[model samples]
Target: MHQDLITLKKICKPIENDLKEFQLEFDNALSSEVRLINSISKYIIKNRGKNIRPILTILSSRLCGEPTPNSYRAAAMMELLHIATLIHDDVVDDATLRRGRPSINKVWKNKLSVLMGDFILSKALINMVRLNDFDALKQISTTAEKLSAGEILQIEKSITRTMTESIYFDMINQKTASLIATSCELGAITTSKLEEDRQSTHSFGQYLGMAFQIKDDLFDILGNESDTGKNSGGDVKKNMWTLPLIFSKNNMTRSQYRLLNKLLNKKRKDGHILKKIYHMVEETGGIDYAKNKLDDFSNRAIDSISSYPNSVIKQSLVDLVGFNVNRVK
Candidate 1:
């Protein structure tokens, strides 16, 4: 494992027991009578990623105050929402793999994948209802809408080939940042009951998530499947323009831009074409541009929480910003 990932483990050390309780809550949230649903849920749990969202929820809660049972439920709800989106995204993208394993769509086909995604989403909704906090319900509901709208907007931009830096940010904000923001806000809502604290953590999570997605954009070009556990250059393959390609488009010459567009418009791109596109973006300094933005957002995230008193939880939140930008996968 990468040292950054180890750093994440250390960051979670402060809330190790809370995370354990969260795991139980998460497991219970996914429990169903249907055998197949149970099997798939088990697989998802077994193949879970870093549990970053839940960590954020728990940490944000601690930073503002103590975590309550509702905080764990909120955390589980956030993760279930994220997982549902990923399952649906794989089906939409026709992706075969996720986190270095065959995707749900690949294993069970798109039809089943779609239904399972719906099932998981329903579970998320159930958790949301159980929260019984009007403020939290509103926040989570808005996030759900934004998540769907973000995906639709991305698909629209890709089909129209009209992706720009502005649209890219808007897309990521809705699709990714909104959830993280809610995770932090929900933590405050469940515990702190202070609007100022809620807003602080929300802003922090929003900036961190923006940095997170940009890092994913960089990984698409620079990272391989073995490292990223994802299909590299997937955005290019799907003609979904990301930050690097979007930033580079204006910097390239007319001919270079035309050639790049031509390749992107193709129904299929071979290794050579993908390599050429990567070089075009690289030569125009797209990679560096993205890294700069990643750092900018990371700093913004840290700044959002600057007023909080120094403590292990606060330091973990700060470390999380670094981990998000530095993680290899």
Candidate 2:
């Protein structure tokens, strides 16, 4: 009775051909005169993950009306900005792997990685100008700003180890949801140019992104390397406490809280550290609470676009929500 991403991808086949259009724009955006940069860019392209942002852009455009050329341009800009952020994030985290491969920062070292990220950002800006859509440009620029602020805030919180529920939501909203929200808004504006339509799609994107990020956080604690393509308890290593651990902290017994705090300060997974954290978090109902929130946010995302007319694209967006709910990887 449940459909996975493979099924959802099949359902969204309407967007398949247009995805090629997005790829062309993306390839053009990353093409550089510098040979080294071009090689790195090609490598990045070859190892790219799911183009969820662009897919959202295309689907949102169709849900509102017919997608336009500007939609592809906007999608390219969003993805470029996203890749730039990921490159910088890897450097900041000193991450060695990304999507199961050596990160650019890991392969090329910090200096070139940093410069490559800047180059991608500059290209995104150039593409934004070429799009000639002032509204889309504004949304994307604001999202770019939000991404930086979110990472800084998360870093600050991780060091202090004092993240509250409100703070966590705000952090994820900026870091994850902002671009998704803007992606849908850009799509809507590209097709309709209507304020209400754009707002609806933006809301849909924000809520879906919220659920998406919560799923990622869950995977940090519960997933295996084979499933997540990363080490288990990576968040713990990073000193970042996600929603489940934080909520559990709030409800933990005094002895449990102190022990948890001490373990977190160690910031290294020795024998049984992760198992202890998981046991304590589950005892306090944090995982269930987070799951409830995931459902709540996914429902809101669904409601946001429920008013749209019946169409396969709309159904595909709905299927995406279902896929997010049931996703294991």
Candidate 3:
């Protein structure tokens, strides 16, 4: 993880100072008169994850042209929306941990967690309105819709056990990729009004996010809690068969399929069963298959920005592809 940050250090340097300001704005945006809200907001500020979304926003702006005065504000809104989703996600998943700390839901219980998520969403929307960029507003609003719809879709698939390759792609695209795509689009529009550049950056973000989510899913199966800073295989425990599991199931023999299905149903929550499942996934090339897909998307993302002239910012965007796909956490 330290090495991962090192790889992105050059990438993030271009916007490092701006990101600091953005962080301050992010913290300030959460301020409220209410007592519990302030406490929860402070906790969120303290335990925030890497501000990758906002950095991406700033870098995407630099890649196209000079960012507007509202660039960081747009970036802050992105982070706010992301944090809100995470707050809600923990409650829905009943997750006990986030970034290796006790989750908001765990510490404050479901009611406060859900309300905090709502508060963040309201703040993001209010900030978006203040920005007064109709196009960017539309982009982010569409993203908010996708995020909610995607989770519902994933939960439905998990409940019905009807997740196909196509549905899986759509789920990840909406749940993870849409906001990233919006981040890039917002940046480009804030910097340059050129529709072509905006579209191009949005595509870059979408492809990059696809790879990013799949890589995360890979970690969900293979990573340690200490390394990933979250519950490993929690998705599987909830019957959310991600790419690796889906591919591995496809490769199983009749008896093996029966065994795996039975184990997943009976022992999905069992940590002991995961080592065996991981081994089976590896032996059957499930991990290899997902890695291939990840590589494909990473390359696609790079290609999306290839038209941009060589520059520090361009190289940073390129480096981000490697950083995201290679990150273990």
Candidate 4:
């Protein structure tokens, strides 16, 4: 196992029992009488990645106050929503693998995958209603809207090929940061119900999420499929502009810009073209620029939580931020 993953386990040691309870709630929430749904749900459970959102939810709750049954329910609901999004995303991307296993669409086909995503979304809704917290419901509903809007905006930018640094940050803020922000906020809502705690954790999550998305974008250029668990250069292949490419575009000479445009216009790009693009971005310091932004967001995330008194949970949250920055996958 990667050392970062090992450190993650240690960071979660403070909330191990809380995580176990959350697992029980999460498993219970996925149950269904329909055989196909059950089978798909089992497969999802088996193939799920590190339950990062739930961990954030639970840890935030602990940070605010003692964990409650409602905290677990909120955690489970967040995980269900996250899973539903992934299922839909795979279908949209025509992806064959997820978390290093055959994607739902690959095994079950797109139609079934879409339906399964809906079913899981319905389950998430059920969990939300079970919480009976109006604030939680409202936050999650808004987050759901943001998630859809973020994805739609990405698709629009990809089609128009008009992505900028500001727009890139905006798209990721909506698409990725919103859910994580809500995850932390929900924890405070379900536990301490303190506005200060809520604001701090939400800010923390938003910053961390921004950094997280940039890291994933970096992986698209620099990481291999084995390490990333998804195809590298996917953004380049799809003509989806990410931070490195976007930064590099500003620095490119007229001839280099033409070459980039030529490569992007191609119906299919060979590995040689891909390698050249990678080197282009690297030489222009695009990778370093993105890394600097990532570190900025990470430092801001740590600063967001500095007001909280020191504790194992507080340190765990701090470690979580570092873990994200250092994570290879």
What tens digits encode model 4's per-residue C-alpha lDDT throughout 1-329? 78877988999999999999999999999898899999999889989878889999999999999988999999999999999999999999997767777888988999999999999999999999999999999999999999999989998999998999999999999999999999988889999898899999999999999999999999988987788888888888899999999999999898989888888888887778788889989998899999999999999999999998999999999999999889988
Model-by-model lDDT, in order? 0.92, 0.87, 0.89, 0.91
lDDT of 1 at 179: 93
Provide the lDDT at 235 for model 3.
Answer: 86
Q: Could you estimate the TM-score for every candidate? A: 0.98, 0.96, 0.97, 0.98
- The TM-score of candidate 3 is 0.97
List residue ranges in candidate 3 displaced over 4 A. Answer: none
For model 4, the superposed segments whose C-alpha errors exceed 4 Å read none
- Please, what are the lDDT tens digits per residue for candidate 2 over residues 54-146? 988999998888888899999998899889999998888887768778888878899999999999999999989988878877788788899
Off by over 4 Å in 2: 1-5
What C-alpha lDDT does candidate 3 achieve relative to the native structure? 0.89
Worst 10 residues of 4 by lDDT: 95-104
Model 2, position 195, has a per-residue lDDT of 93
lDDT of 3 by residue, 36-130 (tens): 89998889988988888998899998888887767889999999999999999999889888999999888899999899999999999988998
Ranking by TM-score: 4, 1, 3, 2
